[model samples]
Target: MAVVVALGAFLMTLFGGWVAQRVIDRRHLVLGLAGGLMLGVVGLDLLPEALSAAGDDLFGVPEALLLFVGGFLFAHAVERLLAVRRAAHGAADWGAEPGGPAKGKERVPQVGLTAAAAMVGHSLMDGIALGAAFQVGGGMGATVALAVITHDFADGFNTYTITSLYGNDRRKALGMLVADALAPLVGAASTLLFTLPEELLGGYLGFFGGVLLYLAAAEILPEAHHDHPALSTLLCTVAGVGFIWCVVGISGG
Candidate 1:
């Protein structure tokens, strides 16, 4: 049943990537909504659940919060390392000529590959969340599944856009998009093999919440607002959050 539900997410991800390929005009709007949806999930779903499930404190902080910080820093480190590597490689290729047009554009794919890989990892975790939630209760599982399914569209869109934006070939970007789409299915299936402890699940949720929050605030939202900053885009973001709120409400009932 969980796998069946994840199939919906898989389709949504493919649709998102297709939309990204076809629609350039509404990029900001799409990104805005995606960012908003991510924010809503972290705040309204993941964090609360993590807090409730986390069992104890670590160094006077909740274990979930500690994992949250760890996740944030972990993502920050990954980005920084990728940036440094890109800079060094770019400079080497350009021969230290100040502002010389970067010669080895091919190397730029590394950045996108890294980012897309992270998104794929997150999607897998989303599947695990679905399975774990079902183990707890049907209502909880369905709610988590709804959030994961909705957020996955953004995952697919960002996976393609980030890969292409970083100079990867269309084929590579599409490949990653397909992998991201399939990851949840794998994760959901894995749940049948094993279950995580509640405390550990809380920690994982906190960690992933931080990851999604960072991506939404630090990456996606900024990119969305970078060019247009129009009222319509802002409204799209608001509507995205409102949509999630309704989903949460309905699922809770």
Candidate 2:
């Protein structure tokens, strides 16, 4: 039953990806909205849940918060390392070439792929949470599933946008989108065999949240305004955040 309900998330994700593909021409708007959605998910959804689940402290701070900082630093370090390696290997001509495409922005395809992969992992966790909720009761399961399905649309949108933003091919972006869509189902099914530890899940969520926040604040938002400094893009970002807020409110989270 849990797995069956996850089909809703799968379909919603595909629809979201389709919407992103349709507006491929408005690159700035897409990044702006994606940045907002990522920020909302990290702040309003993931962090609160992580705090509740991983209620441990290290020194004077919560473990989840500590992991959150670690996650941010880790993402930054990885990006820098990748950039350095590419430069050393003579592959770092990341800026626009003369007389090339008009939107010749710097892109790091690997970073995009990594971020999308993290989204997929988070979706898988969502499915696991769905199945676990059902184990408690149908009402709980339904509530959790509703939250997962709604936010998953945003997840799909951000996944595709990030993948494309980093210079990955359309085919690769679509492939990642598909993987993300299917993750919930696989995660739900896996729960039939075993349940995950809550503390571990919380820690993972905290870390992933940091990575996502870094992408939004450092990468996506700046890129959105780099070329086309428009007010509509900023509005789209605010709308994106509001959308998630509405979803969380409706879900009683």
Candidate 3:
């Protein structure tokens, strides 16, 4: 059942990348909605479950929260390293010529590949979460699956966009997109081989919540608003949150 639910996410991922290739005008709206859905999942679903599962405190703070902070900082540090690497390579590729277009096109593919790869890792974790949730209970599993399915569209969109934006060839970007789509299925199946401790599962859920929050705020929303601050895009974000809320309500009941 968990694998079946994960398939929905896989299909949504493909659809998202396909839409990205075909549609240019409403890209911002799509991104806004994706960001909102991620935010909703973290706030409305993952956090509460993590807190419930992670009982007691660690160093006077919730263990799950500590893990959350760690996840956020870890992602930040990795992104910083990637940025520094990109800049150094950019300088090397283009030389120190002023007014040059920074013809660092060769370096761009590496940056895109790195970012997309990270997203694929994240998607795999999402699958793990789905399988682990089912271990806890069916209702919990369904809720997590729903969240994963919706957020996956954003994952695929970002994977393709990041790859292409960084000068990766269309073929390479599409290849990464396909890999991202398949990652969750692999993750879910892996869970059938081993079980995670409840506390550990909570920690992972909290950590992933932080990851989703960071991606939504740092990557998706900023890009959504960068060029297109249209009212419709903003509305789409709100609608995305509302949609998740409705889904959660229905699934929970």
Candidate 4:
């Protein structure tokens, strides 16, 4: 049952990805919406949890550092991959060349690999959220499950849109759709692993928070800045954060 719900949640995320693809021409808008949504989630949700999870202990300092660094490193690796792709294409191939698709397929695999790896943490975070949902009693658990499904739809749309735009891979975009569709199932199956010591729960959640934070700051948000008016992006970002805050309050967390 949990697996079914988890799968449904991930599929919703993929559906978001599919929908995101339609607005490919306006990549900036896609990134702006996705980045704003992700950043808002981080501001209203992930950052606070990360701070609280660190607590007032000396040992936890390192864990917090680990969480931040892990996310940062993930971003760095992705950036490096992008850089390498650009270098291989001689700076001209990245949408500037007059070659007109004559030589762009060489790095498609790397593009896909980098994309999958960079976005991979989202899967684990979904699993952790699932693990968290199991706590709200059976009825609340069901509601939580439904909520996961709902948000994942947005998440999928964002990821699909960004990855497809960046990697320029239609197949990979579809693959993202498929993968995210299956992610909730994987998350549901992961409950077996997530059922852990209560003391360790905060650390787990913090890590997930870090992943979300990294996605917002590194992938989606930066893309929002690309080829768009700064003022427009800034306003969208604020609105997103404000909206998320309102929703978070409604969620009572």
TM-score of 3: 0.85
Q: Write the per-residue lDDT of candidate 3 for residues 22-102, one digit (tens) a residue.
A: 886777887888878777777887788888888669879998998888878877777686673343235434545665674
Clashing pairs in 3: none
lDDT order of candidates, top first: 3, 1, 2, 4
User: When superposed on Cα atoms, how far off is each prediction in RMSD?
Assistant: 4.6, 5.9, 4.2, 5.0
Top TM-score prediction, candidate number: 3
TM-score of each: 0.81, 0.62, 0.85, 0.68
Report lDDT (Cα) of residue 180, candidate 2: 97
Residues 1-253, candidate 2: write the lDDT tens digits: 8899999999988877988778544767866877777777678877787787788999989988988899898877865754522322222233444554543345568877887787788789778877776664564466557556765776687678778777889999999999999999998898788765888767766776686677678766876786778999999889878877876777676
Clashing pairs in 2: none
State the lDDT at 51 in candidate 2. 82
Which parts of model 4 are misplaced by more than 4 Å? 1-8, 50-56, 59-62, 78-93, 100-114, 117-121, 133-173, 192-194
The residue-by-residue lDDT of candidate 1 on 6-83, one tens digit each, is: 999899889889987898668788778877777777787778888889959988899998888788888777767666
Which ten contiguous residues of candidate 3 have the minimum total lDDT? 84-93
After superposition, which runs of candidate 1 have C-alpha atoms over 4 Å from their true positions? 83-107, 165-168
lDDT of 1: 0.78
